[model samples]
Target chain A: MSDAYAVRDNILTHHFSDGSGCIFFDPMDNSMVAATKPVEELLNKEKSESDEQHCHIINTLLIHKMITKL
Target chain B: MCRRIYGDRFTHSIQPSEFIDFRIGIKYPNFTRRFLKPQVQFSSEGLVPFTPLPADYAFAMLEWGMNWTVAMYEFQRVIIHSAVLAKDDYAILLPAPPGSGKSTATAYLENNGWRLLSDEMALITKNTTQVTPFVRPICLKNASIDLCKQMFSHGTFSETAYKTHKGDVAHMSPQRHSIEEQSTPANIVGIVFPQYSKDILLDIYPMDKTSAMVKFSENSFNFNFLGQQSFETNVHLIENTRQFELHYSDLSEVNAFLNEEFCK
Candidate 1:
């Protein structure tokens, strides 16, 4: 089984048309998280745990319930 | 005072059977206060929602009370604490904090042929890019109060309330054109965050959608309560409009920029 992070079911994502950034809205906590295009791409698929910036983003998403580990 | 400032805006009398959305009154707090150091209170539907202010501030309090009534109770539409102005039915939202030179810019734009949607709030229909006009007097504080008076010499103004929480406060009646088209709604075309700076004549920076959404959300009055709906509505707004941050000291320069950029 693979241990990957996936966006939470209740989280709503909106991607900008210009690919500049993305916004995630979690209704459960009524919180909004804004991510750059690269970070949004990283969240959409699999993320490597070794990169410090990626790790930090994942940790924040996890804390905000925007992403869940599987 | 209302007669002088409001002009013919309230020329039509309300019918006795007509429904009134808000029943508000600005009156002296007490009998002794009326004669002594007179203070005024704002009440809506028989409930006073704010502290009494000096009698000189009665009109200002009334305007603030009206804004409070709408922001506090009106939930059908997504309200942003922004000044909205339009040119030929295309609207631009100016979402900025107090002392951000929003009102000063709005006063200039509205007088310069742009229709004023609202000076304090942008009432956008739920999940739509359409913003309805909530036209009212533009509130001018401190230095802007005097500046607007000199700039628009023909403009009607209320009595100045000195030393209020928001500094010296005054209200300028919206142009007759705006008042006449109060029932009309405009399509959202752009969002501009304005900051007045003495050093900058005019400096505009294009804002990405993500940054615009985050900043716009911070200015929403009911974003937290509306949750997903508010998020979706805001996203819809950002996607459909160009966003920018404008820092300027000159109203004429700001006016020219908006006319060339968004108005056209």
Candidate 2:
């Protein structure tokens, strides 16, 4: 559960630890290991959302151009 | 010809990149088959996961993964699966989480005349005292980004990757001088897990090899995938080095102590 807590240093830190979820934020890279199945699912969801956003932008641009041509 | 190194096996093909062994490949269920092969293939395609990165970046990722795996095979003794920083080849491995001062310490150490083995990665070969330089840039966060830039005028900062769960993050370019002259297989005399805190003190004492491996692998990028191979490599690393836990307020004193100890 995403708890509503006061921001520390203007950054909202969320802790979602159920029994099965093991999230490790390594000092190694921007990446972290989240044994939680949700983390991987979130990654995949983010990918599709980004693609959708890209498509939306292109379609909007094309529509704007067509309307301006008339 | 492309050559792939899987533990003891070195398979070669007239291709670009090779596979990372079946055992290692199986862990990342989301990974594509192209990434599954234990052989090398050629590609300039921007094939990195998620972000449509440039071909060069993808190539870098491939080279890093394969070289790391290859090194595991060649270096049978004392290869840490941890972040390493060296001052004149006397190095300390900082194995901790993001908030743990690992990259921050690296930035400080490099500024204080230390050769950076890696900003956030360590690959130990079978048997050698050479510490190779992956020499990636040191990434920092909001307060750190400003503080580091102010503390060291020689620092080169990257644009912040922007607000994430980890706050605003940026990276500092590695000292090119070190990059040019650095070597791998340096004698790992110390291993320290660094964590940032309000005051500075050495909180945890030297941990044994077995415990160190357990903690280190907990942060490994592909430990689960590499399975037994990864396990064996880490076991080798711990067997040869001493481990400790270092907690610090900031980089100033930590830099001084590490330099005094490692740089002779």
Candidate 3:
């Protein structure tokens, strides 16, 4: 089964107009993560290790408590 | 002197309303030397009082009181500490530190066909591109007092109060057109951080969004206090509006640049 992760509760996303990236803020953890559109989209998708990069990113965020396994 | 010059600009009403929003007053303490050395004190709702000033500074106290009232009570909109002027519904925000000559530039721009949205506080709406107008007089300091008066010989100014904390201070009434259009809101088109220098050529520099966002957050009066709402509004605004830093000495050249760049 592919690993799926979603943004943790209390995480807010803001898309930048310059197409650089978006900021994810978690007030409870007092953290802000800059992510690209694809990364954010992957965040809402079903857990899948099919894309190793996306899976690694979600796994890293999970370690940081910024995301959770779906 | 202030009464003689800016009396007409103030909205004088003797009628008291139960729905009072801001109750600000300046009072003098009664003591043996009260008549000899008259002192002025400012308070809102009789709390958070300020130290006394000389009698000549009554007008300055009043102006500061107005600013305090708005900053303290007006929370519906995000308040950015900056000078704002607009033309054709496109507003430019000039956010700067003290002694940046922002007010001087604002006065010149307002006189030259641009509508003066605000000289101090920019009332930005929550989660929108609009900025509500404060539409009050601009505060001019020290050398700027003489500079503005020399430029606009016929302009109305409150009497100069010297030796205050910010040195000499005076208020310049916005043009009649600005006050007349006070009710209208303007869509923000850009943010300009101004820096003044003596006898220097005008210079324009493009600012990156990250830096602009950081500076705006710092300059905003209630950015952190409003928390998530302020964050969302600021991000939205920065994403949509262009940002710049303007360094200049001559108002004429600066005006030319602004007209060509944003006014169209």
Error of 3 at B99 (Å): 1.4
Number of the top DockQ candidate: 1
User: Can you give the DockQ of every candidate in the order shown?
Assistant: 0.81, 0.01, 0.18
Among these predictions, the greatest lDDT belongs to: 1
Task: Give the least accurate 10-residue stretch of model 2 chain B, judged by summed lDDT.
Answer: B1-10
Q: Encode model 1's per-residue lDDT on B83-200: one tens digit a residue.
A: 9999888899999998898999999999897999999999999989999999889999999999999999999999999999999999999999998889999999999999999977
lDDT preference between candidates 2 and 3, better one = 3
Query: What is candidate 3's lDDT per residue for A11-31, written digit by digit as tens?
Result: 776666666555666665434
Chain B TM-score for all candidates, comma-separated: 0.96, 0.66, 0.93
What value of lDDT does candidate 2 attain over all alpha carbons?
0.52
Per-residue lDDT tens digits for candidate 3, residues B1-264, read 545544564456645653566788776756743687888778887685577789789888888888888877778999999999999899999998889999899989998989999999999999888999988879999999999999988888888899999999999987888978888999998999999999999899987676677677777787556777777888888988988898998988888888888877
Interface RMSD (Cα, Å) for model 2 = 11.7
Note the residue pairs that clash in candidate 1: none
Global lDDT scores for all candidate models:
0.88, 0.52, 0.81
Q: Which stretches of candidate 2 lie above 4 Å from their native place?
A: A1-70, B1-48, B51-81, B126-130, B183-185, B202-204, B259-264
Q: Could you tell me how far off, in angstroms, the CA of residue B40 lies in candidate 2 after the best superposition?
A: 27
In Å, residue B155's CA in model 2 sits off its true spot by 1.6
**Local accuracy of candidate 2 as per-residue lDDT tens digits, B1-264:** 012111112343435564433122212223453354422332222232232322223323343444455444433333344567775557677777767767667777777777777765676553343456565556577688887888877666655545544676666766766666554546677777878887656454655444554577676655544444554455445555666666678677777766655566
